[model samples]
Target: MPTPDFIRDLRRHVGTAELWIPAVRAVVVRRRADGRVLPSPEVLLVRRSDDGAWTVTAGILEPGEDPADGAIREVQEETALTACPVRVAGVFAHGPVEYTNGDRCRYLDTVFEMETLDGEPRVNDDESIDVGWFPVTALPESLAEDQRMVIGWALDAGAPAQFTEPGTSHTEAAGEPAAQHD
Candidate 1:
């Protein structure tokens, strides 16, 4: 999707200045017909149109929107899937992202562990070029480190929501650093 109208309006005033944006990520996992989370579950991922990288469903929250609602909305909009937010998996301050257009922003991200309720995965919007599910043990190499970290938190459902302290990397916050599997 194009930049939201509210952000565009803000951009007109702030130009490319760094903005603190609230965003949400949905780590959607599919369960078995018996309602148990699969012993080896699959996660919904989108291949981003902007960079062709595989990542969890994520987007900026609309002003005044509840973070969980925004996560559900983004999943439906981006992947044509309906998901229920099971829990808040993690929160992080991510990026001083510089877009190709030169817009800069840092995201305060709320990550949710979601259960897929219905619908097939597909590229439902322009933001993504493809959408599909991959087993947690065999995710695509293109997925980013931060995305992988959030996925790990979601899978470790019993663990408390992970948070990062200022100047600490996600690995340090979560403990020992490792690869995507964490």
Candidate 2:
């Protein structure tokens, strides 16, 4: 979809300043006919209209919205798919992305491992040009780096949510699970 009304309103005051936005990604995975997710599973991906890059369904979280709900909402909005979030797959800080319009944003992104509840994939909104599923081993070459990492987390069944630590690159931190604190 277009820039959300809340962000547009914020832009009126901030004017291209870097804003820390909360975003969510739904890495919707499809199980085999026998209900098996292992070996090789399919993942839903969209080809973005702006960049034509393949990525999982993702969008900015609405104010006060739960992150998982935001992820489900984005999947429906962008790909016409109803999904249920199974677990948080990862969380990461991504981007000081400078848009063509000069809006800059750094996103604190929550990634969810989701299952498709219903509906076939289709480009349901202006944000994406196409939508389809691909096996994890055969993902599009144009998939974004961060998205690839999040998908990896989702595919690693039973793994804890992945997180990056200070002074570590995302690749270096990929295998590290979020620490549990007492």
Candidate 3:
């Protein structure tokens, strides 16, 4: 995944205090022909060029861009995978990721469950050092902690759309009953 020039310039000047930004991530999964999701289905993940930690296809939404469209575009831009979001899987306020230069930023992100329409993943841009599909149970050891929970839930066919409240333990919010997706 290539880092846009504007982002590179912004990073150079960003300082220690946390900056909040809206972002989106695509949890793209494969399904069996019968429409049942595969157990331990493969998911698309990308290794960050700077940190090497794996994260799902994601990016900051361009000014006023819709989150679903951003999710689709980011998946394509980052992984060479074309996808369409099925539904909202979850939403979160994550980070305070402190860069080496001490600049920190937090993401208010929406995670969407998407179905791949075409294309195999390859590193499509420089922002990512590598890209591949991995079974949910065998994800890369360097997977980003912020993304792991949602990835797990999305892979589990029985899991429902999760709604998390910021600043609380994820466990405390894990299993409230809710409407199911089709």
Candidate 4:
């Protein structure tokens, strides 16, 4: 993904300081039901140009930006799809990556379950090399496990928003356990 100019400028100013930035991720899904609310197996995924990893739409939150609005904006900017966030799925802190440019940072990411309101996904920006809907069951191996966990939670109907402690297993959260598959 192309680094936004604001971030590049911020990196220059911050130098090596360990800053905690706010970020957001959108898990855009559709429901395919037989007799109940069953989320479709497919969710939108983007291939990051930077690492070639397939993941959900996400970006850093700008100063004073609301997380919900940021989530919507990131989805449009990254995937060219209009998103209506149904609810927050998870909040997490991931970080300590030292950029090759010598800047260090961590992101407190809020993940949202969203429905696509309009527009089909295409590469809207250089952040993603490609964008498409993919089956959640057969997600690319390159996708991050944490991202997969968030998607799983988002697909579970009526799930409450979650705050996942960093480094803990996703199966252990602040509510009833997710449905088991047998």
Candidate 5:
């Protein structure tokens, strides 16, 4: 049997056909400075040059890239921040998404909480022309509904009401959930 088109695109980076899944990743960026969390937590976002819409720093993982490592790398590449993805914030299933370039695919987005180390980011790739930090309170009006939702959750990652799966215990301060967005 031949692989389906959706599956083929999903596995194009893979060396061989095996059990497979299509995935997306984003770095939920946060600043390390004090007094940063308040009425709104500013997060790094990029406006795609292709469609003129804003989105979290993200990308499809390469066949061999560790999912978590790819999240870190994508964020760095998009935001130009020296940061670390400290923990997985949550997973979201964004059913088929259609890109402006004619790529249609479903993605299971793995959101990661990232801590930044230095300087603000400049636009780093053709996917985007502008990148900057914005408050969780007033995210860009153009963000994709799904991207807005995940960024909203990531901002409240320091709160203490949301559920964190047991294995996500590597994070010491992982209980608080932020209010829903989008």
Candidate 6:
């Protein structure tokens, strides 16, 4: 039989494995320009406190927290933007590799099109460094590739349409099935 230390080491290694099955949360998106809800010219984006990664508001779901509630809370906490849940854009099994923390956790990213209520978003320094509005065509350059894909999917699928696949982020553009990440 292995020693306790051996078991500890084994767990440390396997704990990070996808088999570990970490819980993931949904990501939310909002339309600004020419929106049915808010006739505006700006869209919200968040600048992560770490890595300065600018992207749509998102976060991990807490134990027993409703997925929709988590998305609303995260976006509000990260961007301070009041938004109404519109529809599910898609779901993706992603990010089992890396994160702001060195420790890895898998992500089940649910893309949503939320409607902004009032007050432009300002970054909540605890979770994000900066938050502001931008035109869809002139989004900040710091957006991650994944964000680009999500935004692309939202634009292509015309938010409000339901998507449940990982490629819901790019199915229309792919012509065929969009490449699955997980």
Best by lDDT: 1
Please identify which of the two predictions, 4 or 5, would achieve the higher lDDT against the true structure.
4
How should the candidates be ordered by lDDT, best one leading? Answer: 1, 2, 4, 3, 5, 6
* Sliding window of 10 residues with minimal summed lDDT for model 3: 173-182
Question: Superposing all C-alpha atoms, what RMSD in Å does each candidate have to the true structure?
Answer: 4.4, 5.8, 6.6, 6.7, 8.8, 7.9
Give the TM-scores of the predictions, in the order they appear: 0.88, 0.88, 0.77, 0.82, 0.68, 0.66
Q: Where does model 4 exceed 4 Å of error?
A: 32-39, 166-182
lDDT of candidate 5 over 57-160, digit per residue (tens): 77766666787788777777777777677667777544333333343444546677777766668986666788887777778775655566566566666643
lDDT of 3 by residue, 23-106 (tens): 887888876525676675788878778666777877888778899999999899888888998878888765545565565666
lDDT for 39 in candidate 3 is 75
Q: Model 6, range 73-175, lDDT digits (tens) per residue?
A: 7667667766766666656655445433344544566666676675567865466677776667787876655666666555554555444454432333333
Q: What is the C-alpha lDDT of each candidate?
A: 0.82, 0.80, 0.71, 0.75, 0.59, 0.55
Q: Rank the candidates by TM-score, best first.
A: 1, 2, 4, 3, 5, 6
User: What ranges in model 2 sit over 4 Å off?
Assistant: 33-39, 168-182
Q: lDDT, candidate 3, residue 143?
A: 61
- Tell me how far the alpha carbon of residue 170 in candidate 3 is from the true structure, in angstroms, after superposition: 6.3
Better of 4 and 5 by TM-score: 4
Q: After best superposition, candidate 2 residue 7: deviation in angstroms?
A: 0.5
Supply the TM-score for candidate 1.
Answer: 0.88
TM-score quality measure for candidate 4: 0.82
| Candidate 6 residue pairs in clash (backbone atoms < 3 Å) | none
Off by over 4 Å in 5: 1-21, 31-39, 98-103, 158-182
Better of 3 and 6 by TM-score: 3
- Misplaced by over 4 Å in model 1 are 33-39, 169-182
TM-score (C-alpha, index-matched) for candidate 6? 0.66
Best by TM-score: 1
lDDT of 3 at 53: 72
